[model samples]
Target: AVLKATGAKGVAEPAAVLAAGGGRLLVKKMKWKNVTVAIAEISNPLSVSPNEPAL
Candidate 1:
């Protein structure tokens, strides 16, 4: 749905974690007006490949 609307592959919050490496979400997406926020805890930075996409 977000991808269809914005052309982004994924949402910002979870994607941030995946971008860093990969992790578990500590706080799910929270929204207010046009603002959105989320928190994630990276589990193992070395496990995720740098060449991989965040999806």
Candidate 2:
């Protein structure tokens, strides 16, 4: 199966690998003040990466 991850730490490697396999990588920032919650409005942003596959 394909792999997935989120946030800054997950922006590389896995994202590239998944994209290379024809997958979109969804990324969002986690809110750390109160709890671990997503508070961003982003979508399949891996298209900019050199190794990511085209949409």
Candidate 3:
């Protein structure tokens, strides 16, 4: 259910997961979309940080 919501196939390999270091979740796209979505849960609940800063 969670995977479907996020559109991820499955958890990344052990090494890849370690490399991420809890920084972000990598999502693999199925279609030809030229975009990637990384998901992660933040620890600081009160902090409101934008996913991407203005360019």
Candidate 4:
């Protein structure tokens, strides 16, 4: 929800994001309760962390 509000894309599957070359976007690893969430920021003008996997 937070990611959506920020105009970012929320990918439920990390593999999918990596496969789509979304590693350049701002990606965040969050944890809520027992679930792990991956949030990608597509609105950012700069690229995300280079260390991130490209799938």
How high is the CA lDDT of each candidate model?
0.72, 0.42, 0.42, 0.54
Error of 4 at 30 (Å): 0.5
How many steric clashes between backbone atoms does each model show? 0, 0, 0, 0
Off by over 4 Å in 3: 1-32, 47-55
The sequence of per-residue lDDT tens digits that candidate 3 reaches over residues 30-49 is: 32355333444333334544
Runs of candidate 4 with Cα error greater than 4 angstroms are: 1-16, 41-55
lDDT of 3 at 13: 38
Q: If scored against the real structure, what TM-score would every candidate get?
A: 0.49, 0.24, 0.26, 0.31
- Model 2 steric clash pairs: none
The prediction achieving the highest lDDT against the true structure is 1
Question: In what order do the candidates fall by lDDT, top score first?
Answer: 1, 4, 3, 2
lDDT of 2: 0.42
Stretches of model 2 off by over 4 angstroms after superposition: 1-9, 22-53
Error of 3 at 33 (Å): 0.4
Per-residue C-alpha lDDT of model 1 across residues 24-55, encoded as one tens digit per residue: 88787887888777778767856768999644
TM-score of 1: 0.49
lDDT of 4 by residue, 1-55 (tens): 6486656555554643564455443455676786756655443325657788543
Q: Report RMSD for candidate 2.
A: 11.2
| lDDT by residue for model 2 (1-55), tens | 0133433443344544444453443444354555443222224444467686543
> Which 10-residue window in model 3 sums to the lowest lDDT?
36-45
Off by over 4 Å in 1: 1-5, 8-10, 45-55
User: What shift in Å separates residue 29 of candidate 2 from its native position after superposition?
Assistant: 19
